[model samples]
Target: MPRRKKTFLCGHQGYGQICHRCDQTRTQREKADHARAEKKQKKQEWEAAFAQDPIDLRDLPDHVVVKARSIIAGLMTNTNYRDFGGKRLRHNRFIISIPVTRNYRMLCRDCGSFLVPEEVLSHEEYNVCKPGG
Candidate 1:
């Protein structure tokens, strides 16, 4: 005796009781949906994390945000700004600029005892904010 192919309700012919083609397609769709849902949830969590940051980092690139956060954490823990290659702005001694990346900088304010992160700005934005820039 040999198995015979039969048409399922989905119009797909297969040897199984159910349409394997449709079932395979449905499983693939479910997997895709699950993946999309997970991605959405991760994005939501990432967005929510910004609220806890001392400075607004929502607009910075992902890598810049992560670097800025690490710098902020280091500053909070009494790390020397010099260690991170940070320098006080020539025009504004109270403002410190720390390089977050080649194109981004993190500015912090001198608050007597500790540095308070102000904002993360692109290289162009930082230059525009400088005197005569």
Candidate 2:
């Protein structure tokens, strides 16, 4: 004998005991909800991490933030600023500029023995902040 399609209360016809169409849609919606929740959790974690940083890196791009953190870690370990291709600002000898990326720079203050991270700025911002750009 052959099986027959039956209409479920959802008004969907299928061979199964439950309406496969509604079930599929429900499953997809659950999966999407799960994914959205996961993404939100990750975003929260990312935001929380900024509190631990010595400088405010919230406005920088992801890659620039990572690079700046690495440089900050290196500086904390007594690494030489020159090793990171950093140079003292011509106008302000106490201020050191480290290249976080081609378009971004991390400024630090020379605190006698170690460097204190100040801020991360884009090329345009850096230029504008200089005495003569």
Candidate 3:
């Protein structure tokens, strides 16, 4: 008896003596081995990272979403956002533009003089004197 020459298409194992010709069995095994190795490598990398506690936000990728002073500076000059009425309220990540003023005229019931709206927003209290008194 003599040891025979053998070629392996898959795994480390060699086919038996009668396996000299090619067959589907060899191809299937080789494909399976390749898929298994890929799966194992992915699993090892995943486990190595996932085993530790996740990083906090402070340890996240260094990205400055916004420099605070720069943002404040931008906001300071962004007055065009104000409505024609001179009022602005932001809510829900949206600018809520409510009319700060509308056409309004006021007459002194006592003095018969007209008063502007700007004076009204600041007065807090008013006592218009009558002409006769």
Candidate 4:
């Protein structure tokens, strides 16, 4: 079988004479620019017809930060010091409200036995996890 000969366009080894197609595409792109702006303006007009909810930063509750830390701590058990949001958390950085509550699913500091939340030894008692006080 004869090996097919390769062709070049506009001196381009990949698509030699196809440079005319590239020029045609460029011309079409410029022609579409005006329509693109019109479409953008129409989209803005449609969006302006609706009302968006505004974030009330001052309305944030005090428990939000602590609750967030607790949730993140739970995530840390599986994730390596990384929060559920993919943010790296420092060892000492977290909510300190959750006391050593006995958790039936939690393991002991020395032993791998599960204890209740109220019975689970917290950082203050077992010095195991230092996430919360």
Candidate 5:
């Protein structure tokens, strides 16, 4: 094949040169900068959503401290945590009080009758009442 003439925007790749390699490098640099910016933005949003409370491990119960440490480790490694409207997690970090009589049999204050706490627990326990006949 006969040699076709090629052209260069600059004589020896100096300033103002629009070479293929330079264009690719510029594109890669732009992509990298964009990704870094996105990561930074995500970090800021996450920080805003959750404020970390610093608790002295020494002041906490040994088991509580151990569980907290494990959760921290999971967060640091980006695993083992799920968001439940920011209320609950896979682990019970907060206490959930279930309404129940102190014993299986208890006096119903309303009717003064001995009653067994319901087997199924629910918020309805708050309205527990009996007709004082």
Candidate 6:
């Protein structure tokens, strides 16, 4: 058999090669993969924690719903939405609105008007334009 060539940390007893370099590269790759997996897990956990539930108007208390109804009622009386503003009612408009993927508005079937739960609009006329009774 020929004399063995000088070899590095890899432990291969054949041709000239560095031994520990392969091990170091493998360890580095494993560390990178572990960090990536950790990042993905953290993102999934955050999404689960902050996920929103569907809105149901009926489930809300009477007091929470009253102002929204009144705002819609006021809009029917020829008042501009901007003028008939209530911060609290507008903030909670999601309660009355049917949840849609993209467009989130209370549609009135009677007059074919889109209504914002928080504001009054003379043109939208939610009272006259009754939707689903």
lDDT computed for candidate 1: 0.89
lDDT of 5: 0.38
lDDT tens digits, residues 3-109, model 6?
A: 67666555654454455567678899999999999999986864553232122334333443444455455656744445543222233332233321122233322
Task: Please write out the lDDT profile of model 2 over residues 1-133, one tens digit for every residue.
Answer: 7999999998889997799999999999999999999999999998999999999999999999989999999999999999999999988899999999999999999989999999999999998888222
* Residue-by-residue lDDT tens digits, candidate 5, 57-113: 343334444454444444346432342111221233231122222211111121122
Question: In model 3, what lDDT does residue 125 have?
Answer: 21
Q: Which stretches of candidate 2 lie over 4 Å from their true place?
A: 131-133
User: Model 2 lDDT vs. the true structure?
Assistant: 0.92
Runs in model 1 deviating more than 4 A are: 131-133
Candidates sorted on TM-score, descending: 1, 2, 5, 6, 3, 4
- TM-scores for candidates 1 onward, in order: 0.86, 0.82, 0.24, 0.21, 0.32, 0.30
Cα deviation of 9 in candidate 4 (Å)?
8.9
Tens digit of per-residue lDDT, candidate 4, span 69-111: 3543463454332223322123322222232123211221211
Residue pairs with clashing backbones, model 2: none
List the global CA lDDT of all models.
0.89, 0.92, 0.32, 0.37, 0.38, 0.44
Candidate 3 RMSD to the real structure: 21.7
Better of 1 and 2 by TM-score: 1
Residue 131 in candidate 1 has what lDDT?
26
After superposition on all CA atoms, what RMSD does each candidate show versus the true structure?
Answer: 2.3, 2.6, 21.7, 16.4, 17.6, 13.6
**Candidate 1, 1-133: lDDT as tens digits:** 8989898887889887788899899999999999999999999999999999999999888999999999999999999888999999887898888899999988888889999888888999978877212
CA error at residue 65 for candidate 5, angstroms: 16
TM-score pick, better of 3 and 4: 3
